[model samples]
Target: MVLWENLQAVLAQRGVAGFGVTTAAPFPEMAARLEDAVASGRSAGLPFTFGDPATAADIRVSFPWASRLVVVATSYLPAAGSPGAGVPGRARIARFATRDHYRPLREALEAVAGLLTAAGHRAAVVSDDHRLVDRAAAVRAGVGWPGKSTLVLVPGAGPWVLLGSVVTDAELPVSEPMRRTCGTCVACLPACPTGAIVAPGMLDARRCLAAVLQSAGWIPLELRAAVGDRLYGCDDCLEACPPGDRALATATAEQGSVDVSRLLAMDDATLRAEFPHFYVPRNSGRWLRRNCLVVLGNTGGAAAIGVLAGYAGHRDSMLRGHAVWALGRIDDPRGRGVLTRVAASDPDAAVVAEAATALAGTLTG
Candidate 1:
């Protein structure tokens, strides 16, 4: 076993606020899911091929030689009233997404990896991908527990934290998983406008606003109304819980409020410049723009009509389609002309169909 003092000192210097270690075991479900993930990604427009198992079996096979799975938690929650603070209209980016935790977390994990490698031990660091739910793994690792809202809530950090795991061949002291502390709290369930959290600890991701906003492809119309002005992940469930409300309020009060209007107005260049570390840019800005359109439609006020109209003729097929949908929601007469124009001229069949449908809805309404 490695000296606990040395490991703790290393983490302290690396700025990791809290961490834990768990035994790496054979997770059969995870392995099967990995195979399906690879096959699906191959046809799902993923740039590169992912092998059946993302995590090498060697890690588990050599677990007899390895010591522990070092899990780390970093405090990414902004201080109260920080720039990330506010409701959907103000467009608060989740603290984790805004600061871009992957790289910094990776760097910190690497430092720990370095220490082990130098000691002639094997180590690997895992970060976020579509397949692995890092939060679930963290919860199982004893760093936290899944709350009513389906977010991993750490004891001190609440749910406003991001997790990363370092699986190593070296065994270290381990921490027990935190017990479910929800204590019959049902605040998050009622708070979800779409009822994505039908039951505690069970999240239908398809209905989860956060998952919906981050998703690629067309959003069904039925869910749009419930999505509200949320340009990205929905925080209502989180905001409504007592612990969440208090934690977010405290964090935001310390940090300045986020401005949704400013976020909507940011062009591609400004977005890249402003949110250099953000995950939104990685999607090439299409999903963000689409999400903004949904929020604009939900606003349904004169202020957003012009902006929605402006995007009606955007070159991006996804942007144009969402613009047309937003125009339908706003019921702006001016949108009729733009929709008709797009309906006739857009090369993408899906864009053309959406525009035509929006035009028809406006004329009939």
Candidate 2:
């Protein structure tokens, strides 16, 4: 217990917002739940814990040398910054991702691991998309209850915290698990613009704008309109959650908005360098540009005409397809001119098809 007390002080000094411990037990409940989500296609293409539910749930299975699980939550942003605020010609990045919090979360976990190591115990730091059922561990460790948004909501801090875990063979005691629930508050359910939250505690990632943005392909046609100038990350649901309201930070318009046109003009390397925190698929700038096109499509309007036109003929067919979609979504006569050309002669079949659709919509709309 003395070592545990020292550990808490260590974590506090390191700026960890909250933490708890649970026996490194297999998360059987999480395994069952993940299997169900995966079977329903709700977990499709998700790169997080859903990848291997069984192994993720059972921390010991992957790290058989582990005997204790230490879960930690770090508030990356002091408050949720600029929620749902859209400035035309610009897009919003989720406050959680306005900067990377996971790195610090790992650092804190590593600090905790260091203490255990000094005590002659082996420790492993597992966090953020590393195959641990982190939320389950957090809940079991009394960190917080899972919010309706599928985030671990620490009291007062809400779900505006990042989660990480330290696995060790130490004999540290576990914290009593939290018994709270959102209790009938379904505020987060209807808050989602794309209806990603299907139930109080269930989220269908297939329709989640946040998940869609991180995913490696073109934005879904059905959800593109709802994206609403979001270049990366969608915070509609989290911002709407009442618990996180008190902690919401007022962001200057300049702080929250990214210029869609300017971002579209950035070459691949520049995009990666600017947003090392973003989960760009294969580190390709095309994916980031792909997202930029959707934002321009939704909010760029006439101001985005030039950038969209340039990308419509980009060497990457994927980018070309998304740019075509943006051109179609906009109502400018110049946009129409570009779409007509794309519809007639873009080499990619998908890009051509998108161009034709945009052209038809122009005629009928």
Candidate 3:
């Protein structure tokens, strides 16, 4: 108890904001998963050790061991007037992924780890590394529950919060569970554009736009159409939550609104300059460009025809395929020749079929 008070003071004085500390469930299933992920070399940048629970148990059994878990929620609201605001011609970026936080979050947890070590406890900090479910751990540590959109929504900060965890061999007083407050509200469910939420708590990752975007390379046609100009993560579910809306508005106020048009107008060098930290380039420029084209197609007007046409002959097959689809939606004479050329040589059956259909309409017109 005295140790808990000391640690709490350390966090408060260091400008570290958080809810409270809680204990992890001593379950074999959790331990096994952590072991498997770490042993298989899958826990590259993750924070948990392969034998974390065992290590803690060993220390407690043989020595005067204390085990405690501290969870923190950091505000990662985007800049005021960010591109997340409702606008045409630009794609949306998930607020956390868009801004830089992984580095700072890591630093804060390191401080917590140092405090635990100084108190005669072994400590480790956990961050998301594309494998571990840190959110689940945080939730169990009484941080928060999974919102309907499947994002962890901490009370005051809402779902815009980023989570971090500190697992230590320090026996400290545990904080009471933060009660699940998602009572009777299904706002996040309907907010999902493609109905990907499936049910209240389960998410079908295949249909999730954020998961899909991270999956660069060859994108399916139906999915591409659903992309709807969102080059990065989809915020429909988050923006749909009643609590989430206020958070986004608050985030918007703090960070500014995000304009899609500003993003669409960027050249290669300009995009690099504007978004150097973005992960959009993992699939190269084609995926994001294709997403912008899809958004333009959805908006359907004479305005974006030139922009779609410009990418009609892009070197990447993925970009060319999506460009043809965008041009098909535009239904302009300017797109006919390019669509014909694409239809004639396209190796992908889906792209060819759509191109043929569009070219047929052009010939008849």
Candidate 4:
């Protein structure tokens, strides 16, 4: 108990918003739920969620001797007036990725691990890493309750906090689980732009625009419209929650948005330097470019047609396909002409298919 108290003090000094300790027992219920989600194909296209369910459900599997888990939540919400508002022609980034919150949280967790090690106990830190189900750990630790959006919702802080944990062999006093519930609140269900929240606490990652944007390959045509001006992740469901409003009020707005045109103009090196957090594959700018194209099509004016037109014949089939869609979305004669050219001569079958679809929509409408 003294060690646990000392750890709590250490976390408090490190600015960890809330934390609790729980026994590292296997979460059979969580494992069952994950298995169900995967079996139902609700977690499709998410590689991280596809690992061994048993391992993910148990901290002890990752650290065989682990007996205590310290779960911590840190608020990443920025000050209310930092930036991220009223920026036209810019794609919106999710609040969590606006800054590097993980680095700080990791540093804090490492410090906690060090404290445990100094006391002759073995400890391992995990954050954003897939060693265990972080939300489940946080719930068991009494740090927060899981909201319908599948995010851990801390009282007053809502879902704006990032979660991490320290797995240790020391037997510490365990905290009680939180008693709060969402009750009759279903605000996050209909608020999902892509209907990703299929039901309370159940998310279909396949239909999630946020997951689609991060995923490799072409964005499906059916979901592109719902993606709208988002360049990276979606926050509609979180934003609609009542608790989330309070979180935003205290959170500082992110400093800036990536201008859609500027992003399109950036090369690989420039994109990486500007937004290091984005999961750019092999340091390629194509993914960012693909997202930018979508935002341009959703929000750009006549000038955007010219920018998108240039990519109609890009070497990358994915880019070329999205460019064709962007052109049709702009629905300008020049864009239509470019789509027509791509439909006739694009070497890639996928690009040709996308161009044909875009052209068909344009011609008929």
Candidate 5:
């Protein structure tokens, strides 16, 4: 018991915002919920969420002697006045991805695990890994309750905290689950631009702007408009919650708004170094460029049309299609000329179709 208390203190000193211990039991209910979600197509396009239910539900499967689970929350919120303010002609990234919180969270958990090992107990640390359903562990440990946005909402920190856990054989005292709930507050439901939140605690990843942005391939036309100027992740749902405002106020802003024009001009190496925390698919710059094109269409001025015109004949169908879309959105004479050329000569069927559709929209509008 004394060791557990000391471990908690150590985590706090190391900047872990909140933490709790719980029995390392399989999360049968969570597993069932995941299965149902997948069956309903709510988990569409997310490969990470489609593993064997039993494996994710049971920590003991990975660490057979596991008896206790220590779940920890780390706040990635930037300090006050750290440039989180929205910038016109720039893209907004989700709050959580502003910095690499996983590294520090892992270190803190490992430290706790070391203490357990020194006491003759085995330990395994996991953070942002696919091995366990981290949210379930946090909920069971009383670290926080799951918010409607599908984020673990810490008491004062709201949903701006990242979650991780340390599974061990130590028989530490367990914390009771939180009794709090979001209740009748449906703020996040209407706030989702793509209406991804179908229920109080349910989220459909297919329609989620954040999920779509992270996903590889072309952005679906229907959801493209709702994506707005967000280049990476969406924060509309979190921003709408009352508690979320407080969390933002206290969080240290780690990143400033991204300049879409600058991003479009960057090469692979430049993009990777500029946003190291971003999940750039296969270390390719095309994904970032793809997103930047969307932002350009949404917020760019006459200057953007010239920049976008360059990609009108891009070899990559995804880029060429999006470039056509941006050209149509800008609706400038130069952009129109490029679109006409792509519509007539682009070899890719998808790109040709998109160009024709975009050109038609321009003529009609």
Candidate 6:
């Protein structure tokens, strides 16, 4: 108890959004839920979603002697009056990935772990890493309640807080769980642009635009238009959440949007370097370029036709394929002309197929 009190003071002074403690007991229910998701094929695209319930539920698996788990929260909200990333010819970035929020959250957790270590107790920290169900830990810790968006909504920060935790062997007091719930509010459900949130607190990663963008294969034809101008991550569901919204006002979801034309202009290394925290498959920029082309198609209009045309000849078949879709989305004569050339000359069957689809849409519309 004394150790917890000391940790609380330390966290408060460090500007952490909030902190709470829970027993490091096995979360059998959470494990069962994940098991059901994986077995039922509900977990898609998210690699961490794999494995049996034990891996997802029990903190003891990772920290064999852990007796207490200290969950921490840090606001990811943009500072007031800060410049936003949204622009007319660019794509929007989710508020979380606008920058590295996890770094600070981890730092805070490490601080708590450090205090435990100095007291001769074993301790470890984790954040977005798959070792722990952070939201479940957070809920048990009484730091917050799970909101309809599947995000932990803190008392003052809504779903705008990033989560991390320190697992320690110290037998600290278990936190009192929050009594709050979203009640009848379900705004996050309909706010999902791609209908990714099929129900309250449930997410279908396959239909999630952010997850799809991070995926390795072709962008599903049915979902391309919903990608809109989003270059990375989707915040619509989080944005629609109304609890603790006073703190939410400072974050501009558009703050991290990148200039699609400028981003597409960069070489592969530069593009990945520009967003160090983004989850690009294979750490490759090709997927990012694929996303940009889609954004250009949705919102680039006449100004983006030239850009789309250039990508139509890109060496990567995937890029060329997405570019074809973008060209069709722009529907400019010049873009269509590029698609015509691609339909005839492109070497990849998939690219040609994409071109055929894009061109067919033109004829039918």
Specify the poorest-scoring 10-residue window by lDDT in model 2: 247-256
RMSD of each: 4.6, 1.8, 5.8, 1.8, 1.9, 1.9
List the pairs of residues colliding in candidate 4: 78-251, 78-252, 79-251, 79-252, 80-252
Runs of candidate 3 with Cα error greater than 4 angstroms are 13-17, 24-66, 78-86, 253-276, 280-283, 345-350, 357-365
- Model 4 agreement with the true structure over 1-365: per-residue lDDT tens digits: 77777888889898776889899998898889888888899877465535677888887777999999989998776532233633546788777777676877888899889989999999999877666889999999999998988988998778878899999999888999999988889999998988889888889999998788888888888998787888777778878888868667766545546688887887878877887876655767788889889888887767788788887867788898998888887768998889888989988988889899998988997
lDDT string, candidate 6, 214-330, tens digits: 888888999998988788887777778887567766654335656889999999999999999899889999888988988888888889888888888887888889999888876
Q: Indicate the residue-level lDDT of 84 in model 6.
A: 47
Clashes of 6: 1
Show where candidate 4 strays beyond 4 Å: 79-88, 252-256, 280-283
Each model's TM-score?
0.77, 0.95, 0.77, 0.95, 0.95, 0.95
Report the C-alpha lDDT of model 3 over 1-365, residue by residue, as the tens digit: 77677767776765543546665444455456556546654433234344354542232232233365578777565432245444555556666656575656677788878878887788877665322356665676676776877688876557766677777767667777667778999988876876777778666666777767755655556776677656667677766766555656655443323344455557666765565555653525555566667777666456777777766666666766667877777667777777888788877776788788767755774
Lowest lDDT block of 10, candidate 3:
56-65
TM-score of candidate 2 relative to the true fold:
0.95
Give the Cα lDDT of each candidate: 0.67, 0.82, 0.64, 0.82, 0.81, 0.83
The ten-residue window of minimal lDDT in model 6 covers: 79-88
Which residue pairs come into collision in candidate 5?
A: 77-251, 77-252, 78-251, 78-252, 78-253, 79-252, 79-253
Error of model 3, residue 76, in angstroms: 1.8
Write one digit per residue (lDDT tens) for candidate 1, span 125-215: 7656432346656776787777878777776667766677777777677788877678978888888888777667666666777777777
For model 4, what is the alpha-carbon lDDT of residue 223?
A: 90
Sorted by lDDT, highest first, which candidate order results? 6, 2, 4, 5, 1, 3
Could you give candidate 2's per-residue lDDT for residues 301-325 as a string of tens digits?
7888998899888898989998888
